[model samples]
Target: MKHWIHNKLAKVPAGIVIAALATAWALGAVLNEHGMARQDRHEVVRMTEKMKTVCVGRFLLDLPKEAQITFSTPRIDGFTVVIFPETLDEFQTRLAEREALIKAKPDRLGGDRNLEVAKEVRGDGGMTGKLLVHSRAVKEGTASNGLEIERYRHEGVAVEALMHGNGVSVNLASDFYFPDMVGNVLKLAVKLVPNPENKVPAEPGFCMDGAYLRDPLTADQLEQITMFARLPSNPDIRFLLILAAGLQPDKDGLIERDAATKSQFSPTERMRFSRLRAAPRTIGGIYGEEVVKRVHELNDSIVYSFWWEVAGTTDNIFVPHIVFQMDTGEGDHGPVPSSLSEGAAMGMWDRISSSIRVRPTQPPERVAAESPPTPLGSYAWAGERCPESGWWQCSDGGNGIGVLGGQRQYIRKGERMPQALLLPPQTLWEKLRGVQPSFESKTQTSWKLVDKRSRKRVPSPLPLAQATPVAAAGITSAGTGPSVMEQQGVAVGSFAATGLPCPASGWWLCDDPRALDGTRWFARGSLLPPATFALPPGGFSRSANSAKSIERRGAWRLVRLADAPEQAASDDNGKLA
Candidate 1:
């Protein structure tokens, strides 16, 4: 077989071999391009999917009250719910229903049907206590195949219950086809007793003064009071308990009196006396023996201390001044609170507490100084000035001097001024020279002549003769060679002989001359120069090169060859390189 392959390879032409290599290279290039294109398409799809998920989450969160009240927000944060039955019979019934539903559509739900019935129990049955019940349906592999398949299509439902001293606090969080199931249950409860006060039994627990204390107390207070109550009893115990409860000594000094009484007795005897003092006491004095200390302690525990320097006061009440603070993890800190509620005191407290957190001290004020003025004429460039000849001029179409009136005027390049005040030949010559002459002079000459036919006195042809010669020379010079001025026709002796005078405004003539019927004339007033020279050299060439260099330098390039490889991998894996 090897000998046969060698024979066939030898018979292949060199051109054919080269063509085959080229074709393989082309195929590889096409495949690479296709792979890159495919990767980009996948990236777009993935980003679209992520955006859809985010949009769904936002839509759920931003729903109006009516919508949110009906359907709970999507569970971006992990949360589970368990339903507890009040009695064993109720538990058995609910269990049986769950089992039947699972059996009816095993593919639509999940649970362990054969598990012990008592093991699924939650709460203390009829006893008042909190308990957590696990949903056999939501367990791994327990959901019906059909329900599990729809996990991505919809959220599911779960239930939970906590038995408080007064009643039960039921939580129904669902992850099912409809999120409104839990909401519906809550709505039913709300309809039964729309008002919480009405729904919650007023006398569920003993409402004794101290009993109410335990009911509204915070976790810290509850722990502290429970520990204090469990302490060894003594005659001074009542005083201590009262103090712990925030009650101050009465005007009769009953608390101190009780303390003194306990000091003289033995520990056992003091314990007995303390129990006797536990009963409420009254004193016949200016101030009655009240539980002022107990109220103070309660207030101290509930009211967070803060420095509230405010602008005003009313009704002898300190309107709380609030300051808010947020942690962004970037070390940036500032006060966020701006306003306080008015009308309802309770509303004001809620707003202030929720919006502001007390800080140890105020932040220092930021002081910024004014920036210095920019340097004068910093943007000025070269070739921006007018030339000599007392004519106003500007590269841009802006104000320039009026040659005749000595006033500032505006003119554009390539536009001719009126012939009423035509520029003199000498003045035109000087302007073309681009510099003031060493010797400046003005001359005017007149001559008399006889008409060929009438033989009458008339202006001589001398002015015309001299002007004609100069005009011819100018035309020749303009066409053939370099010269200070180019002329196209005879210069009249009127003002051409005497150079045009410079106005007070200092206008300068442009180098270019206007031509009319072969008569070349200089502009009498200053001109607005061309914004850009038609033919520029030197510096312009350098500017073009600089621009090209900047473009070349600005082009993006991969810093490392390995970066390309990494990028390719990342693209394939849908990750940032």
Candidate 2:
């Protein structure tokens, strides 16, 4: 058979023989590549156990029970948390290597990249801490022709403080345009308490009698928090979570659809923008959009990135933008090989993304009226259920109601707070909020309970001549005239005023002193009517001629969409009858 084949090949043209061999080699290469991709495509992910909840900013997300989580507010507008699938010691090795590489970079561009300041200091509560300051000097050289000035300097100074206690360490970093922040940064470091639980301790932990690190960023156009996790069985597989509140939004408090997302990519990025999945998704109670793309590079390696964002509003801290990115591959710039199959990566994303939700401040069945009243100065987010009905002052800084001088508002318990537009500063007000050149950004306001009296209260029966002015008695309308929707044309929290047309058709919560009937269905474009409360039979009977009932023009807030499944479960009329 070999002799016969050789004779046949001799009879064939040399060119044809060479062509056949080339074709076979090409076919084999294609098959090898196809097999590699298939291996990733069919990888299976088995979530063997129930998920555990971890708090990230104003929301909660479920993860594998074995995942180790750490929380940090690395930036004023950002919160970051890292979850390790393996033991902390194993992850530390990877981090140590990365840090060493960063430290080895040679100084260039007429600037020094040396660690100029490193010292150990004792913080409050006997906590030991290390202060690190890396400074790059401002370099000024003679102009090219000695006519102009040539200057080079890094943008800002960074002060990092690491506190060690309770077998855990807390890191806090601050960036300042000047070096004057060192003193304040030290002050902040001493006040930090490293509690592994990341919760407000019932009693002091390892820190002094001061506030632990929480949401301390009060700057406008600044909102960020990040969370990262990896699989314990496969530390190479990782997940990242990011939240940003300063992204600009439309009138409805949603990110400006495609334009905003497209702007995230530069010219080179646009070329690699291999879209995989892009659609609308609602995580927690906020309405937002998402885009998932697979990155195919020149080296034939691949990466899958996910982007999601919601509108920034004056109602809650869970506004602006959020992202969930996953990496299932080896690091250290080695050969790009994913640890998990593509199917496994997508399956994990679906499981965790679906579990994202606003952390419940109260039980679902707990009625606002029945719950204990929230005291003055208590803080609440916009989307959260109002703990007490009264006046709330927006402390989110120069945004929301402040743009129109209506920062303090009357909001009833059980009613959703509204949203407002935070006009970009035309002056130096930008520096006041930390980040200058502030653009139009939507962020949830941290509202504080200021008053405990509602507008249009049910007055006691008194003779007309003796009736005193509500304001004269130190009780005035907390209602700031028009709603944020009416004044700023931006609904703070998807809410509509009583006289305004309903922004959306849904169950609207009545902002009444007494939550009358909780929520009622309302149609879009229809005027939200007033909520009437009947007076108790003999509670206010100074005379038989006294008023028997009172009507309050309360603002109506959209609680649920008209298409919710529970809409059909109720048979009562869609009014507070």
Candidate 3:
């Protein structure tokens, strides 16, 4: 090739060859420029072809019809349902890419099912399932059957699925008759404005088991709209259930972990149960554990905390809770007593609790097929979802910068409440009556006893008793205050022992106004030690001191004459220590 070029150059005249070569070089450059321009034009044309204005919703479309838009303002954290115009195309493109990359894929849905489901989501706003009303049906199995879902020509499939990350989720597609399900999903991510009454650090993680209403509110306007201040007269009812996990069992068969449960013993809070009860529960055909604690809130409204640990959920957990909020009548703040009647409420709890179940196992392995709507992953890569993930300046239609404004919402949702509270209805009347059930007799009684001096059924003020000595186990390491479990048995005659059956207040503490003896005498808050209080206290002292007073024992200062303070045995007759 070099020799041929030299020969050709040699044959031409020096000026002519130089002129010809320059002309040839110029022509080549022109052709190259035209080729590049054609390629760029083709690229632009192809990009435009892939994108077209898509109908997202009524009064809403992609690329803005004359500069219009639709979306939530001041978007909430952890709860976003925006369908960007670009999502469908991106989803199709990315799904193909993922299908190639995903090696350990689970069974996939049918191609027809995928196409049908995608069409439904685009044509309809969102879809639920047929199990909406059948609260008894198990979800895990119902969810796994994709292609098996019967599809109707006039309507969407009874069951539809979307690809969410690595998992292929089968959703029971419906008309969303049970829209209140949003409350369950939303609360998991909703922000609880700081409250002076309750001090929850953040929103708790929870799940919802929603049942579709046979007859739901049909206001099309309200379908897409939501009220920020309060729930509807009857939002689609659901169980805003929170599940708490138990720690490994210790020697006493107790899982001693931080409960972080809401404080039920507040000054204004009323106690309905004398002590924690570990009763057996058989809910939803799943037998497991149960614990019930009832209390009345500051406004005399009653609510209780129910904790259940269904059996066989996992080996690591003794009982995985299915916590629930059961309100009786209208609470102090809300207008509705409950979405259901008292009978209905009980029925719902039992039915749903009975329905609470573990995720069903998958069918045997079989050759899989492809299915739709981002056919296999979480939210779309960018666009509408970018803001939620702090990914700005991303996708073709996004930076999400204009949408997020300068204030990015930080997520604190999904953090378990540490505890949940519920109230039963009858509590209001009881609160109005201003009476509590005694632990001893388990009967309704007055908050105050028959005053010894006043001869009235009012709390008698008791004088602050002098500090008594506490046993080693009773005194906590710091001794700052009483601990929940510190206990020591005191042995004294019934005469000097404190009353056995506890009062409605549930505590024998000196600070409790209900427990005080009209300031004449009261239980000790802090004590030194038993030997110290005894003076080697004058025990079985000079006779005639038969007046036996109830003396509380231990750091908790249990208000019972169960056992009397340490005292020297009476010589022949009773003596006071």
Pick by TM-score: which candidate is best?
2
Candidate 2 lDDT over 8-110, as tens digits, reads 8887878798999999999999998888666644443345265677666556678877665544344442222122133345434644553454356544453
Candidate 3 C-alpha lDDT tens digits along 471-528:
3225422322222223332311111223222211112333324333322222232332
Highest lDDT scorer? 2
Error of 2 at 337 (Å): 4.7
- Each candidate: how many clashes? 39, 18, 47
Q: Report the C-alpha lDDT of model 1 over 1-577, residue by residue, as the tens digit.
A: 9899988887787669899999999999999887866665554343223210001100101111111111122121122222222354554455466545534542333535322111111121122221122333333433367545433233343333222222223332333323222222221111111111211223211011111111222212111111011111111111011011212213334444545765997766444321211223222111112111111111122111111112111221111111111111111132222121111212222222232121112333456574332221111111222111122211111122122321112222223322122122246667898743332111010001100111112232222111123243233222321121223222222222113221111112122232011111222221112211122344346565432111000111111111011111111112222
Q: Which structure is stronger by TM-score: 2 or 3?
A: 2
User: Quick one: ranking by lDDT, best first?
Assistant: 2, 3, 1
Against the reference, the lDDT scores of all candidates come to 0.24, 0.53, 0.28
Better of 1 and 2 by TM-score: 2
Question: In candidate 1, residue 511 scores what lDDT?
Answer: 27
